[model samples]
Target: MVKYNCYKPKTEIICSGSSEDVVGQYYQDVGRSDSQGDVDITIGEALQATALTSGEKPVEWSDAAAIHEAEVRATGRKTIMPDGITAAAQSAATRNARTTRDEDKTKLGEVLSNASTKLASDKGATRGDAESVMSVEKRDDPNFTTHPAGVATSIAAAVRLNRRQRPG
Candidate 1:
């Protein structure tokens, strides 16, 4: 059988807001310059609000410490009740764990292996294809038909090539 719990608000509460958020807004509204007065007013307001909401009076001065002690005693939590478990729940959890355990690791290994095989095949195909591709026809290195000597020959060859390529 499955059990479901209903949610209910807490009876006891502590206003754990930052002193700045509480006191700052309070002082700004009260226009208080002194920090002590600001703190006093803020606490008083908090106590009043808590009292009104809980339908109880603030702790008396003499019993304040004892009240706080009692609060502290009642406050702490324990791992008292263990979480619910069922056979179906356990099986679902186990299945999820099994799927997640080596999932990414296995996927990563498969991806890397596939990538390595593809790269090897690509490299072999590229090398073989490159071997068949005709080499660039090596232009006769600066034939220097005119004045076949030094700088003059190279310049003449270059000018001839340019003139041939360019429209007249």
Candidate 2:
């Protein structure tokens, strides 16, 4: 077996053991003590035996990199969400709500801008063109206002709910 201790504040150990100690347990677990000592394990045999104990398929050499990465990640005692991550999540949620509200304002602005554009496009375009593009007309007409405003207002309300309106 080989063991290494690598850390400053606390030691971390990694080790590998002989195939006999590893593989014999596999046969005994399966009620096949007869097969125990009879098996002469190569590295391949030992790995297959370990897999049997785990109820897993045999491991491939290709899995080595992923296994190493998992081990490295597990060895560290760091919190999954550090303070920076928590702060970032809070900021992201805040930014998302702000962006959503800005999008609604931009939509509102577009409606007004488009009305101005169509009204000025040609003086003879008629009231219908101005009426179609204008927010006041849309808001005034109960049918036109219902769907979009309901959705936008609900989203705005949800943003308001998510925000820390009372300064803490």
Candidate 3:
């Protein structure tokens, strides 16, 4: 039999007896004792030698940390979003992501057009050829743009990003 102390700032709980007993109680303490919804808790088991003073015996089980850790383990990372947020909200946020993506591709095309015009004047290819190449590239890669000016203002950031990644 062993004793365990579970500590979260302002909440201290103790459980003694078997290792299973101590660990079970520790989970209970961190889960049910949290009053504020925003606190980040790290659950750890402490040996009796390094334990804090004895605390209340935990009777009920709290699955909060277990559930959260299960999700982190399954997903391999944490989300920026807070808990209790809906699946619908997550889906809603991406509603216009495709629209913005397409618009940015268009802007990237415009930048290609301008550079191509320069190539026609200073390099070997004509402006018409540059334009054709831009169209074909966009067909092959969805990220590229075919008519940048048409959507440049709407997705300036994407245009700038796509412009940097344009094929030579």
Tell me each candidate's TM-score: 0.14, 0.15, 0.15
On residues 2-74, what C-alpha lDDT tens digit does candidate 2 reach at each position?
Answer: 4443432123344456744542221111111122233211111222222233222121221222222212222
What would the per-residue lDDT of candidate 3 be over residues 1-168, giving only the tens digit for each residue? Answer: 333333222233455566544544443332312233422211111001001211111100111122222223222234422431112223322342344454332221221222211210111122332343334434433455433322111122322333344444
lDDT of each: 0.23, 0.26, 0.26
Clashing residue pairs, backbone N/CA/C < 3 A, model 2: none
Cα lDDT, model 1, residue 52: 34
Q: Sort all candidates by TM-score, best to worst.
A: 2, 3, 1
Q: What lDDT does candidate 2 reach at residue 167? A: 35
Clashing residue pairs, backbone N/CA/C < 3 A, model 1? none
Candidate 3: pairs in clash: 105-145, 106-148, 107-148, 109-145, 110-148
